[model samples]
Target: MLLEKINGPDDIKKLEISQLQTLADETRSALINKLSKAGGHQGPNLGVVELTVAIHYVFDSPKDKIVFDVSHQCYPHKILTGRKKAYLDEAHFHDVTGFTNPNESEHDMFIVGHTSTTVSLALGLAKGRDLNGRSENVIALIGDGSLSGGEALEALDYAGEYDRNLIIIVNDNDQSIAENHGGLYKTLKKLRETNGNAEDNLFRAMGLDYRYLEAGHDTAKLVELFESVKNIDHPIVLHIHTTKGKGLPYAEKDRERWHAGGPFNIEDGSPLYPYQGEENVIFSCLKELLDTNKNAIVLNAATPMGLGFVQGVREEYVKRGQFIDVGIAEENAVAMTSGIAKNGGTAVFGTFAPFFQRTYDQMSHDVCLNDSPATFLIMSPGVFGSDSNTHLALCDIQMFAHIPNLIYLAPSSNEEFVQMFRYATTQKQHPVAIRVVNTLRTTGVDDNTDYSVLKSKIEQSGSKIALIAVSGLLTMALEVAEKVKEQTGNDITVINPRFVSGVDEELLVSLKKDHRFVITIEDGELMGGYGQNIAAFYGDSDMRVRCYGISKAFHTEFKAEELLDQHGISVEKLTKEIIAALRSE
Candidate 1:
């Protein structure tokens, strides 16, 4: 096979033009094979096969330094950069992560999973190269979808005036996670239709030299385009139009659904592994909120499907102006939500917890300072979220709870979340943040607890020992309580602190009278988290305190079980620790 001969970029440079085409086909097949077995960014890798091949064939990596925006399209790059074994062999499928990782290979410059950060990062690399008095091709491969990001736009504006050898390749797949948004996308469509000869070219207007290729999938054309700009003295933008899911008919037909997913069958494109969870309460609450509340609206950055508002499902509401997607700009969406709530319209914005980290300033200034009464749903936070270090959002409490006038609630059950959502939208008091953990277990009873009270719930009141649990960790606390009852022949108090923003002073004071030792457990980092408040509250008092949580670090590919156990939040560990503490007293 042509792929066997291609161990690295050196092998690709030795190939003839026709052999290069065969190599592209083989690389695509290998991508499909591994993705079918292990699953990954499907549409992105499939589309970038030719582009990656051409780039490796044209430029020298490691020395040349090509960076991929978001790095979802790095699969083909990995295959060309001496890592094709991971794709061809099923056992080695998980040898590398889906995104760019410097630990995995020398070709990958940065470990990136977030979107639209390529230009700025690449600009930094270019500046470093100049500082060292070295001249090597510095390229940033970004997509049209990423152009809407504030970082990419700022970098593009700066690149226009940057008098250096920097190449910016805009891979115009014409689709983001969903269909493209904003006027720039319309300009891209026009450029594609006009064969890059449109009036008022976007690149040229930005003060950068511009060139567009209609056939981005054409390897020979792409290689020639790359060769034309290599080692050039000035910055340039190469606009290339390509298909999102190039070879797969199903993926091409529904680019959004097939963008990224679990392993699927090659025969009929059905999922090999079923979804691991049942119906989520978050989306159901969102759907009902939009259905009943006419004055209410929902907004997302670029992840509508993450909120269960898939393409056709949200069409009617979108037409009614009840749903808005602001593309990949989280900061804009956050500020816009504040504006919406300020104007007497109910606005709820949702995004993954890690992505929401981008809007910390906007959330603190625009929403909390103005007291906009907007509802921000932080999805899949803590150690239970994505295992990737790039997307780990362990410091949400560190981010949200500290902000003044912001009520950051951690709902312990499905019913609590529903009631919390109701309370957040109905009131006009303060901005609210809800940390929806990886899973929501139900109590099978309706929760009408008044969240405005901001008090912890005591599941079992007892003397000598008190266990204070945060949100999702309440289950573990309860398990530890049961173990304590079974082994120690003593009842331990278990308190679920639903609110993380601040301590319920009355509740903590009440515990001091009866409880001797307090143990606080959370699913997030130990420092600056919900548990610390409890520890500090008993600092000057006779009640000895212990805080258990995941330590401060960018932990990746970790199981919640292992993380919890290591942090001393596990049932067995906590139970024994509780017994030992009581015995000492």
Candidate 2:
């Protein structure tokens, strides 16, 4: 195969111009071959196959570094740069990560996952090369969708003024995770329609020289484009138009559906392994909330699909001015929610917990400080969320709970999540942020607990041992309590702290009366989490407090159950530890 012939950047550089297109073909085949079974950013990687080949064929990587924006398009780049085994062979499918990593290969520059960071990171590389008095072509390969980010805009502006060798490759596939948004995309569309000869070009207006190629999939043309601008004296924008999900028919027709997902059938693009869980509890509840509350507005930053607003359902709310997509900018969505609430409109903003990390300042200053009563649904937090350290939101509690005027609620079950979501949206007293239920288990009964007054629910009362489990860990706590009862015939008090932000001081103080031994368990990190607060409250008390949670570290690629067991949050481990603690006394 032509792909096998080319092992590294050197091999690609030695390849004849005629053989380059064949290599691009094999690279795309390899991308599809693995992605169909392993599943990843299928459309983004497939769209960039020819582009990836062209860059490696022209420029010397490691010397002339190219940084992929979100690293979603790096799969083709990986296949070309000596990592083809992971894609071409199913046995090695679990080898490489879905994103870029410097540790994996010298060819890979940074460990990137989030969007719109390439320009700034590439600028730093260029600046470093200049500082060391070394001359190397530093290239930033960003998507047209990433142009909406403030970092990309700021770096692009600075690049126009910096007199250095920087190449900005704008891979325009005309799609973000969903369809592209904002005023700039319209200008990009104009440029695409006009064959890049449009007047008042955005890049040119930013004082950067520009060139465009409508044939982004053509290997020969792409190589020629890169060769024409190699070692340029100033920064230039190479705008290349390509089709997202290029090789697949259904994927090309529906780009958003093919953007990223689980393993799928190569024949009809049907999911090989689909989610077998019941209908999402949060999505259904949110739909009900919108159906009833006319003034309520739900907002998300680019990831509307993940948060349960799919096309037909989303369009209905959009037409009603009840749902808005802020387009890959979380900071704006958060502050806007606060403004909407201040003006008498009911506002709720939700995004992935990892993405919400960027809005800490906005959530604190604009929303909480003003006490706007905006509701935020922090989705998939703690160990249950994304395992990537870049996207892991284990430290979410440290960011939120300490902030004044913000009430952060954590729900244990489906019913609890529904009730909490209702309370957060209805209450006008403080800014509320609810950590959405990660576990799919339901407690069966309707949750009638009053959240207006912050408190804990004690399921079973007992002396000597008290278990304070936070949110999703409530299930684990109950099992541990049952295990203790089965072993010692002593009922262990199980307390469910629905609200994670504050300690129910009255309830906590009352626990000290009967509970000689207190064990706190949470799904996130032990430090600055819900458990630690309980430990701190009992620091001076006669009660012995032991907080159980994952260590304060950047944990990645771990199974949910395995991570819980490692932290001694599992029923068996907790039961054994409790029995030992009791024996010591």
Candidate 3:
């Protein structure tokens, strides 16, 4: 009832501390109920409800720019900022996104989905405001897990030197998709225990003012803390202690499991959906390699769960000193993996596709330049790209495909992924990056393929037009090809170019004789992607090429299918385009 009456931050500002707690309670319920049915980030949003409410009550958002790191916690902020109906009602669930978006509202400063970017973006806003002779407060709400990231650390070091009005809120819930790793967490634990009196403070070491709050959920204390920094002329770090899954008993007991998941039962917090079976292609392959090879090691950057190496799987490798969780320090992880590989150890770094963006230079210079035989398992690349802009890995192909000596393989099936993972771990030729799109339906394991060859496989041989689809986009292309054949009775050649980085020169040279028009489909960006390289390869040749992928722009808050369709990558769209090209010829 109280939630219905509240419309905006002004309404929240009008409320007393007692009423604010009631508001936080209702907001958490709304979040949990919506996430139960619609399936969005549950634990993070639930934990940040009170903190978000307190910030809105204390700070003048839009005027006082508040940037949420990774922005998963922005759901509660969104609800308070005239967007409650979106999450409270099922019909309006699709209205707002899971992350912060400037396009969605004036309150949201950036369309961020990646971790550890808030500090830098917020600092820039603060600098710009000062330059323009404006005096609006700038706040960055960053998580503890994000602190280990190179960019965040870089920005923190910069912020410490800059004499300006900036407030950095460290939401120390002590988990990051998985349990937090790295030495910084130890510092945070000490700071929390000592109630801000801890010596050797990391924030102070970075040259910033520091304050600690043991009770993050207490709205009165949070408001007081914000008031203290409201008129401050220097950057400061407000470390707030909070629980990852604050309200729910089940979630609080196991923070990692409740981080983010599908629809679940409200009573006992059990998943409503059943398990779709183990992602054994990655897990089994990695397990076998680590088991046999004593010198081989696996690495993850704060996301061991995403790589399907959670719990028992991670512990087994970690005990052997082979599983390294570098927390959010992706740059460090990449370089360390390279060092291990160079020193005659088999090093494989597995991380989500988007996070790998932070390590591009290291993967290219530190690893690829030296030609280290490190294996990179890039999980969930392309259109299977999840949630918000911060999480979408749509530009991975553009980033990795151009790097020389980096063999990027896009596995078509589970069997293909298994074979490729095996090859990547075994081979000493160059760094191999497996572009794992999704957990494909197991087609009974086959270990016959030699991934070392690194060639394109022709799924269906035909004439005139060649459909070169990369990785996960293959299924969509195949569906389009089927429709084209039914309508026009023309058999179009479908080739799965597994290796996106290297030009399958032998395959391309052979295609010149048979195909006249070539169409390349990729799940990443069109500009500087695998498709463009193919287009460039045939620039002076007889074959005319049309590349289909995401355009060079920041696409935000879109369903996977909608994004694909918008980019002319859907089955109907691709089929029409191919037919038109055929007709034009």
Candidate 4:
């Protein structure tokens, strides 16, 4: 096989121009063959096979660095860069990551998983190269969807002025995880329609030379384009239009659904494990809010589907101007939500917890400082969220908890989430952030707790020992209480601290009257987490405090249960520890 013979970019360069297309076809086949079972970014990777092959064939990789924005499209790049076995061999499927890693290969310039970072990163490489008197070409490959991000636009504005050998390849698949948004996308559509002859060119306006290639999948033409800009003195933007999910018929027809998913049937594109059509609680709450309140709106950066606002379900609300997708711009989304709230409109912005890292500055300055009553839902935080080191949001509490004028609520059950959501939207006092659990634990009852008064609820009352469970770990806390009761004939107190931002001074002081041991178990980082607040609250008291949480580290590819167990958060371990503490006293 052509792919088997190919080991690296050097091997691809050894092949004749006529054989490059054959190699690209092989690379795509290998990528599909693996992802059909393992599942990953199918559409992005499938679309970039030819472009990656052409880039590798024309440019000297390790010397001439190539940075892939988001790196979701780097599977084809990985297959050609001495990592084909990970795609071709089933046993080796677990060998490589879905994104580019500098640790994995020298061909990979950065370990990037976030979007809209390539241009800036490539600019740094170019600047360093110039400073060191090196002349290696620095290339940045970014998708059209990522172009909507503030960072990419800022970098593009600067790259236009930098006089150096830098190549910017705009892979215009015309889609983000969903359909593209923003006025920039309209400019892109115009450029594509006119075949880059339009007078209103975003790239040229930035002061950079531009070229257009319509046949993006044609390996030879892509190679020609790359060759022309190989060692150019000035920075250039190569705008190439390509189809997302190029070779797969099903993926091509439904681009959004094929962005990323689990293993599927290759023949009919049926999921291997069919979706059970579970109720999306988040979307149901949003629908209820929008249906009742005309002034209420929901906003997401680029991940509309993350809040369960899929293509079919979101269109009607979007038409009503109640649903807004800012398109890969989380910073802008946060600031806009603050504005929406200040103007007496109910605004809720949510995305994956990791993505919230980008909006810390805006969340602090624009939202919290202004005390805008904007509701922000932090989705899938702690050990249960995205397990990649690049995407681990173990610091959500650290980022949001201590911010003044912000009330951060951690709901342990579905009913509580609903209650918190209602309270957050209706209240006009402080900015609210709800840390949504990955799995919804149903209580089958309504939560009518008056959150205006910050307090802790004692789920079960006992003497001597108290367990303060944070959000998702409440279930484990209950189990530990049960085990301790059965084993030691003592019922341990279980406290659910609904609020993370502030300690319930009344409730905490009440605990010190009867409770000797206050153990806080959280699902995030041990340092600067919810547990630490409890520890700090009792620093000068007779009450002994112990905080259990995941250690400070970029932990990845781990089972939530196992990671918790390592932190002594398991029912068996905690029960024994509590029993021992009880016995010692």
Candidate 5:
């Protein structure tokens, strides 16, 4: 096969123009074979196969750097860059991560998982090359979807005046993870319709030289375009239109569903493990709000599906102006939520916890400082969130807990989430953030506690020991209590601290009356986490305090339970430790 003969870009450069199509086809097949079984970025990688082949054929990588935005679309680039065995061989499939890693290959510029960062990263590479008087060309390959992000626009503005060998390729697939949003997409649509001859061009307006190609899948045309921009004196934008899922019929038809997923059937594209169709409590809550309150708005930053608002399910609310997707712009979404709240509208903005890193300034100044009373739901935080270091939000508590006027709530169960979400949306006091777990447990009993009164609920009151469990760790706390009872004939206290940002001072003070040792268990980082607040509260007292949480680091690819156990948070470990501490006393 063509791929078997080729190991790197040098092999591709040796191939004739007529043989390039065969290589591209082989690359696409390899991508399909691995993705169908192992499950990964299907649509994005498939669409970029031809473009990646052409790129390697035209330029000298490692020397001439190419930065892939998000790097989810780098599978084809990986295949052509001496890493094809990771895609072709089943044993080596797990050898490479889904994203670009500098440790794995010199060809990969950065280990990137987030979007809208390629332009800025590539600009830095260009500047460094210029400082050293190197003449190697630098390229930033970004998708049209990522263009709506604030960072991409900022970088593009900078690249406009950069007088060096910088090539910015806008892979216009007319999609982000979902359909593109913001006013910029309108200009992109016009440019695509006119075949890049549109008068009102966003790129050219930014002061960068522009070139357009409609056939992004044509390797011959892509190679010609790359050659034209190679070692150019001034920065330029090459806008090329390409299908998102070019080869697979089902994936091409439903671009969003096929973006990424679990293992799927190769022929029919049916999921190997089909979703059991569990009820989404968060979506139900949003729907109830939208139906009841006319002024209520639900907002997300490019990941509407994360909030249970999939394509068709969200369109109705969108037409009503109650659902808005800011399009990879989390900062804009947070600030907009604040503005909405200040204007007497009920605003709720939510996305995955990792993306909230971009909205720190807006959350602190625009929302919390102003006390807008907006509701922000941080989904899948700590160890329960994305396992990748690039996307892990291990320090979410560190980011949001200390912000003034922001009440960060941690709900332990589905009923608790319902009550807390309802209370947060209805309250007109301070801005509220709820740390939402991926899988929620049910207590069967409806939660009737008024969250307006911030206090921890004592689940099982006992003497000698108190386990103050935060959010998702509440179940483990109960298990520890049960285990201690079975072994030592003692019922240890289990307290569910619903609030993470602020400690329940009254309940904590009361714990000193009967409890000798106070143990705080949280799923986030140990430093500045919920546990530290508890530890600080008992700093001067004789009440011994032990804080349990993830250690501070960029932890990746770990099982949640094993990670907790490693941090001395397991039920058996905690039970034994508690028994020992009691005996010593």
Candidate 6:
């Protein structure tokens, strides 16, 4: 009842410390209830409930810009800023997003989903405000997990030298999506224990003023801390220690499991949805390889869990000195994998799709150029997967496909992924990239596919139009093909181009004889993607090529299916387009 009456930050500012605690409690209830039904970043948002409330109470939002790192914790901020109905009410829950969105409100400055960008973006905004002679404060709320990232560290270094009104809040819940890894976490632990007296303080070393608070959830103390640095004429770091999954006991015990998920039972916190089933072929293959080959090593950039080697899996390999968590430094991870590979050790680096963007140079020069034979498991690539722009991997094809000596493989099934992983690890010929889909139903451990050949597969044979689908878009393409068949009575050639980096020239040339129109569908960006290459390959030829993929702009806060349909990648859209093209002829 109190929450519904409050509309904005002004309403929060009017509340006393006692009321603020009540507000925090209500916010937590709203968050847990919503996430229990809609499924989202539960722990992160729950942990930051008090902190976000304190922030809105202390600072003037929309004017005093607050940037949330990764923005997963912005759910609380959304609740306080006239968006409570979106989360509290079931019918309106879909109205709000999981991350901060500039389109959603003036309060949200940037569309952030990936980690380690808040500091840099905040600094730029602060600099712009200074240039225009505006006195509004700029605050960047970052997490301890994100601090390990190269970009965040770089921004922290930059903020250190530039003297301006900037407040950086380090939300030290002590866990990333998984347990926080890296040397900086050690420093954070020391700072937490000693109350800011830690030697070799990371923030201080970067030349920014540092202050620590042990109880981050205390509204009065947090308000006082913010008041101390609200109008400070220089950059400062406010290190506040808080408990992740604070209100939930089960979540508190195992922070990683409760990081994000679907609806769960409110009584015992048991997941309402059935377990997604863990058939981790990639990690199993890696484990087998490591068991057989002593010289093989694995590397991850802050997301070891994404690669199938979670905490327990990682420890098994780490004991053998084959697994390394290189923190959020992706560039370093790529280079390190290259080094290990070149030094006669079989090396494989695994990370989330968007995070790999940080290692373009290293992936190209250190790994591909040298032809180190390092294996890269690019997890959750293409548009059908992660809906958030900051986390979307739509540009991976554009980035990796052009690289020479790089062999990129997109597996349609889990069986294929396992085979490719094994082949990539054993082969010493060239650097290999596996564009991993989020969910791939295993077809009962069949190692029939030979990845060494590196060619495309025709899922369905036909005569006229050729439908080339890549990675996760295979199913969509097949559905479109069925619709095409119903409309024209002609079976369209549905080909799954499992490899995107290189063109299957032989297959393309062969199709030109019968297929008049070629439609390339990918769950990545249309610009410089696998589709473009197909278009360019048939530039002089008579084949009419149309590419369907995500657009060139940054797309955020969308359902995967809705986004695909919006991009004209649905079964009906593709079928209709094909019929029209045939009729025009």
Quantify all predictions' global Cα lDDT against the true fold.
Answer: 0.90, 0.88, 0.86, 0.93, 0.92, 0.87
Q: Tell me which residue pairs clash in candidate 4.
A: none
lDDT minimum window of 10 residues, candidate 4: 274-283
For model 5, how does the per-residue alpha-carbon lDDT over 1-585 read when each residue is reduced to its tens digit? 889989889999999998999999999999998998899989899999999999999999989999999999999999988889999999999888899999899999999999999999999999999899899989999994899899999999999888888999999998988888989999999999999998999899999999999999999999999998898999999999999988999999999998888889988999999999668889988899999999999999989998999989999999999999989999999999999999999999999999999999999999988999999999999888888888999899999999999999999999999999999999999999999987568899999999999988999989999998988889989998998888888989999988888888988888888888999888989998888988898899998999999998888878898998999989889989999987887
How many pairs of residues collide in model 3?
A: 2
Off by over 4 Å in 1: none
Better of 1 and 4 by TM-score: 4
Worst 10-residue lDDT window, candidate 2? 435-444
Q: Encode model 3's per-residue lDDT on 1-585: one tens digit a residue.
A: 789978888888888877888999998888987888888877788888889988988889879999999888889999999899988899999898888877778889888888889999999999899889999999999994899888898999999899989999999998888888978889988898899888969999989999999999988888888888896899999999888878889988888888788888989998899797765567778888888999999998888887778876688678889899988889999999999999999999988887888888998999999999999988888777664566678888888878889998888878888888888988998999999887354558684778878789898887889999888777777788899999888889999887888778888888888789999988888888888888999999988898888877666667778887888888998899888877886
Question: What tens digits encode model 1's per-residue C-alpha lDDT throughout 449-560?
Answer: 8987888889888888889888888888888889898888899999988889998889888888888888898888999888888888878888788888888888887888
In candidate 6, what are the lDDT values of residues 195-285, reduced to their tens digit? 9998879999989999999989998888889988898899999999988888989888888888888889977889888877786777788
How many clashes (backbone atoms < 3 Å, residues ≥3 apart in a chain or on different chains) does model 1 have?
Answer: 0
lDDT of 4 at 14: 89
> What's model 3's TM-score?
0.93
lDDT value, candidate 3, whole model? 0.86
User: Mind sharing the TM-score for model 1?
Assistant: 0.98
What are the C-alpha RMSDs, in order, of all predicted structures?
Answer: 1.1, 1.2, 2.4, 0.9, 0.9, 2.6
Please write out the lDDT profile of model 4 over residues 375-439, one tens digit for every residue: 99999999999889879998999999999999999999999999999999999999999999786
lDDT string for model 2 (1-585, tens) is 888877788999888889888898888899989988888888888899899999998899888888999899999989888899999999998788888888888998998888889999999999999999988899899993888877798898898898888999999999888777778898999999999999959999999999999999999999999999999888999999999998999989988889989889989999999889788777897788889989989998888887789766798998999989878888889999999999988888998999888898999999998999999999999888888876888888888999999999888888888888888888889999988747746878999877888888997888788998887888888888889888988888899888888888988888778678899988888888888888888888787889988898878778888998988888888899888877777
Q: Candidate 5: minimum summed lDDT over ten consecutive residues — where?
A: 435-444
